[model samples]
Target: MNTLEQLRAGALSGARRLTLRADLRELPEEVYTLADSLEELDLSGNALDDLPADLPRLHRLRVIFCSNNRFARLPEVLGRCKSLEMVGFKANHISDVPAAALPPRLRWLILTDNRIEALPDELGRRARLQKVALAGNRLTALPATMAGCERLELLRISANQFEGLPDWLLTLPRLTWLAHGGNPFSAAQEAEALDNAPMPRVNWADLQVQALLGEGASGHIHRAARADGTAVALKVFKGEVTSDGLPGTELAACLQAGAHPHLIPATGRLSGHPGGADGLLMPLIPPRFRTLAGPPSLASCTRDVYDPALQMAPGAALRLATGMADALAHLHARALTHGDFYAHNMLHDGDGEGRLGDFGAASFLASVPPQQAARLKALDVRALGCLLEELGPRCAQHADAVQVLADACLAAAVDTRPAAHDVAQRLRRLALPCG
Candidate 1:
């Protein structure tokens, strides 16, 4: 939130990061003064449709955010910045991505809530690309060349116009977290889940909403109490498109998830909001429980950010891993994929248990062909492998077995990866030594 006055007065001189949101129509010339040191620039909520042609002067810039702006296309100058790796232009009017707009070293790109109908073929040229957020767009097809991006891991293609998924997309060796809900091909499956589960509906009038627990792109969660004197957590979904897809799609997935020891059970669906907002009612997570880690940051892109001081006892880590494995296996068995399977999506009960939550990115797998469903399951195995690898160093006793499983899960050959059920069974067998 550094202001133009601060820049003009040189008060923010040598600053490594800068964010401006004063309805800027153009980037002030003074901003270039700190080019020698600036590495991150956030110019969201502005009216600017283009960047300074000389933006490449910021030689150290590695990340830039221009969300909520008037840009109709991705700025071409960004491609000239050699150090740039992450770019965000969410909530803009961007309808085109020029071939020269992609930087060579690009690793993560966010174009959510835009009008992008197609992508440049050059996207596949970036070997380091790992995460891409293209949800809520107008994409009918993806560039065939993207299959060359072997390092890609996380992708959000939900809420788009694709008639079907690209076949090459399923073969990416490193892809794990993938969300394709809200597409034409997925609509039937989503509707089927809702029809089959038929979650009990709890009218909003029967509940007393309390303090807000947390909020994200899709909705606000609140501590609530039922008229029958039952305490619950109510998630009032924001009736808008999320980075992944529609909220109703998420609710259907949650309903279909049913009950698993390691899953956050949905007690009922929120019905009859005065304003017609949809919601879900579930058991309140115990106060002692907390998210295992923070969601991915700009720098981490697709990886969860753990507390540097956080360490889990081997028993605790094993317990948490086994719980997540069981939850995921149950999900896949139901022909569902918890598209966002990061540790951040799991809640850790201080003792040893972990509960998988957040169906915002979940998608149905039953509709896909049998072979592709198996491939999708293998993709999720890679996600579990990534999670285990992240929690491995924290384990004290069963570190070897955890590492072995993680490595196998991350095998370059997707078919070589173990199934979620197999991994869960193996994890259950490891009798971790008590502290």
Candidate 2:
């Protein structure tokens, strides 16, 4: 068979998968002949709107990619594909989805950059459904039936009309991840009484200020302790503001998002300080120098600077990378962008584990101006690339593992760079091989 004939022959046969992307606006009838055995298909970046009715005959089909299409509605035939597990319809024009058009086995659904205003109540009935990405849509409210999705773990409903989070949503046992603050329906209470109220005085009797840890452009950090002897970090704001107004407020918001196992936790906000202004209370971190002055390098940390025994080793580096990936995943899942993501902003928890810190530049994705968002994401990618460069030589013995991470960091296109969740998955996979 010639090249075209060979491709056509494969489509006609009982192939388990197919990925045809050569100026095909519509699926040829010949493609349906293998429906029974086809388990995966990729017809993305095409002009197809609806699927052939025979597509439901693909009983073994598990995944489908129909993104970047012109579909106004979901193809009803998908409901018959009982084995369908995932569907990627991002960057489409889909405005509505009939509950009956979805398969019960569907688990991961990606409908980003669509015009969907609402979902049917039956959407929450899918027992196995776990992750749902609905960013860049027009959702006004989530169906209350969503509470029935007991297995749902990650949800991204940012840029919607939610004024407040659904009460039932907050109670879901498996709903550990959420990012929906942009919607009008999800508006949180503002920082009230700030203007009339006097600045809160720091309870010095309840806390002890220690030595200065470091100084940033906007603030100075000090190691501090509570009256009960609990250790914490104190960040006193500088009197002058940079081009951005009130950097302290932004920092406070990032900290209020709370601490992840892989993120340094901010304890509380403190006012009335030695600098004559408000400051932040955070967890105290032992001083550990990172390779920021030059290309990514891991120099031997001296005992006087920080406990040499606590320094990160090869195994520890792998673990720290994995943990940091998860932390980034959490932030990304919530549509929160960490403007700066270098090693300088990450803190080791004394046992090789690490947590993301310094959210002074962090912002909700939708809240950031479009041009600024692009710049921030690009900067983050550069930082990640630098990190990979640092890890590459140290992990030279595991070339393939190192390359995988480096490649993710160095993806040519900003949009093509792996998301935090994808990075975490890759890191986990690399860890197994490196070990």
Candidate 3:
């Protein structure tokens, strides 16, 4: 946090990044002194409604964050920042985004937890756009022009007012992660699933909370035990508008997932949190298990990062890939899309055995036409391809077969990618290592 006094005194004259969170109502003119060097700025938790048109004077600015503010409209001057690539306005009162408010060089845009109902057509014109977050808004429909955003990958339109899914969204070649729960279409599908197969319910008081295991954008997972002294992993959702979608949507997907050998099954649903939050009781993962890789960092916006020294035998690599493909095939069979399919979401025991988890970005398939649903399945194939690409180089055995499978999975033509079930079968046919 850069103090206002330091800024005014020119102590931060040539700073490359500046963060001001002193409930600022306006930016001091002195900030302009660093125009030549400033590249990132964070003005979150402030009271600003607009920005100075001269903001463009910061010729090298590339990222800006103004979350938790009082802005009712996106600052139009932002579009004038020629080098801006990332913009975030989370948890604001923004209700309008002018046609010219988007930066041409934008790659990542986050407007989570806002009051916006629509987006400007100009959004589609940015050829470099990739990641987008519009969850927890009042949107009724998406701009048709967004069909041109061919480079778009991750998208979150959950907790909105949409009555149907659009066809163009299904055809985007690079779209991997998509969350659309809390909308009318999704709500109806969830209701039907609950009516057919409800999850077992467990009261909160019956579980003894122990230590926290991990936390994510959606909720916290804890190591807990039942009143009967049975150990379990408990996930207590934040029960709010997460960047991906609503916690309720994730819970619904969990119930519908049923059981699979490579999936962390939900044994029961949590009924009571003192604060009335949604939660799940899952089988306890082994203490020896750990994440295979880390989630993408801001620098590697859409790719997972792994340890460079990590290596695997051909058989071990094949085993891991087979399990993931089988799990994904199961999800698609149940009309569910594991939107956020990445290595970081998998927990491994170091012997090529692991389970897929995290449904925060999952989407429940409903009334889409068969053709479109098949294309959506192909998108998941691409995600699996990406994971295989990461693992192939490290394997010494069956490298040729793994390369062939990866090539087919990543084919540009959606129809060219093999179905997950077929890939799993092929993997199973490969020779296994001796015990």
Candidate lDDT values, in order: 0.89, 0.63, 0.87
Better of 1 and 2 by TM-score: 1
Q: Model 2 — which ten-residue stretch has the worst lDDT?
A: 295-304
TM-score per candidate, in order? 0.97, 0.50, 0.94
User: lDDT by residue for model 2 over 1-435, one digit each (tens)?
Assistant: 112355566634767777766545777666666766778888887788888887876678888889888999988788788889888788789997998778888887878778889898888888887777786688878888888887665566755555545556644544433444345532331132223223334565567888998887558888889877888888877744321223443453454455577776656667546545767777655556342222122121100122234344666566667777788767655556564465666666434467677664454554444553443344354445555565455453654675676676655444556666676677777776545
In candidate 3, stretches whose alpha carbon ends up further than 4 angstroms from where it belongs are: 5-14, 195-198, 311-314, 431-435
TM-score of 1: 0.97
The total number of steric clashes, by the backbone 3 Å criterion, in model 1 comes to: 0
lDDT of 1 by residue, 1-435 (tens): 788889999999999999998999998999899989999999999999999899999999999999999999899999999999999999999998998999989999999999999999999898999999999999998888999999999999989988887778999989999988888888999888777886889998899999999997789999999999899999999978788878878988998898998999998987899999988898998888889999998877888999887755447887788889999999998889999998898999656788998898888887688888888888889999999998776666678889999999999888789999999888888744442
**Lowest lDDT 10-residue stretch of candidate 3:** 426-435
Order the candidate numbers by TM-score, best to worst: 1, 3, 2
Which prediction has more favorable lDDT, 1 or 3? 1
Error of 1 at 150 (Å): 1.0
**Clashes per candidate, residues 3 or more apart or on different chains:** 0, 11, 0
